[model samples]
Target: MDSDELSEKQNRGVAARIREELARRRVSRQYLADLAKISLSTLEKALSGHRPFTLATTIRLEEALAMRLRVSETLDNVAAISNGHADEQFGAYSRASVAWIEGLYLTVRPSFGDRQAIFAYCTEIHWNEAASNLRFNEKDRLDAAFTQQGTVSIPNLSGHIYLSTNTSGQQRLIIVSRPSITGEMYGILTTLQAGRGAQLTPVAAPIVLIPMKALADAPLGRINPDQPGFDAYAAYLKRTVEEPFAMFLPGVAAP
Candidate 1:
């Protein structure tokens, strides 16, 4: 079937399951509407099958119901390197391609002013072996883990940890440590300022994985972006990303 038809079918499935769960528990729709932080009318429409679920909305619904609506198999499949692609160029395919980052980390970045550490947030990482991907469920699962006391738990909100090879044959891992995207402005500021944007161009800094003991340690408090530890961490990450054969080596660390 086409994309639209598939989406509609998924929506119907989600709506049916949500309604069934609610009915089984004998709870009011308003209870979940409030939990999901969506309006009554909006929740009504979604529950009544008038709207399709976006990824963001699906996450919110998962949080509200304490269950994954429908974990698609597509989310876990990694595209194979094209046939005849040089192993040196594409890197060897392995079940361990993205498993080393499986743990908790406090993602940090420097802000424009004072170079103060922006405590982007604590993100938990895990391997989605089925999908051959890294799972970072910082925003959804960790916060809700302790809440509701008895809510049902699912595997995780797993998605692909994007990676691509550059012309130099270096592998770059793109990480979105922030829960929300920030930093965008339009013409008035950009036109007046030297380094600002004249038109809307949104950009957010991403976390680059470097082999840091602290990243694995996940110290109790927020990480300082300017600290020597973080400095070494960032440097190691950038340097490694530029290396030609670092990751493919056996027994090497993951980022």
Candidate 2:
């Protein structure tokens, strides 16, 4: 086949696979478009064969669906689109360089509703062969449905790491200092606070990601003051403020 014909065939194959995923997942095209951060019109045109899918759009769709759409030439190349190096989108880190971070973490942060309670969960960070970047997923949550999974950004200039989730354009961010000698990361988490039915307010709190191995006996999920491990978990969280990992500025009130 000619180059143009081959490209056209690939586009049609991608469109078909995307349609299959949409149907299998029972998700709407509008939802997919929104999650992929693409305009509905653009998605519709590409899926309907009115326009070809651009590489950027295809990558976005793959990320949204958490699946590969392109048929690579070889399995090795297919394993990493960047040949084991993450693209600029994820700080261009290589898989080998970030190998040390591939492990489970006990993620701790303050409860949005309870001032004295600390919320604890499991966050697994590992390399994604398909995307060639470190990805993180949250588990062991009291509310599993709201658990997040997204790419990890390790920028060298700032000497900080970021765990961010972007769902339908709403973003949640956790900016943390690099791992200490004990592999603990202290930082600040900014996310939407769910209020009474459909109400969400912006909220920020100190957050910590401790290597699960370091606290194998620690408890998970809603560590209240009455809980056994609450003191230890609270201590780890306090370091976020005491060590001054992040600062919250209270703006000047009206005089």
Q: Top model by TM-score, which number?
A: 2
lDDT of 2 by residue, 82-196 (tens): 7778878678898888899889999999988789999999898877654567878777788765777777999888999998887657789999999999999999999999999
Q: What lDDT tens digits, residue by residue, belong to model 1 across residues 1-255?
A: 333332765676677767865654445788667767777787788777676666666667666654546535344222342221213322333435434444544543333223444333344544332223333333222223211211101122423233221212212233222122221100100001113454433323424432224454543223366444656445533433354212323455535
- Candidate 2: regions farther than 4 A off: 1-76
TM-score, each model?
0.33, 0.74
lDDT of each: 0.41, 0.81
Residue 7's C-alpha lDDT in candidate 2?
61
* Total backbone collisions, model 2: 0
State the TM-score for model 2: 0.74
Q: Where is model 1 more than 4 Å wrong at Cα?
A: 1-9, 12-97, 118-120, 127-137, 140-255
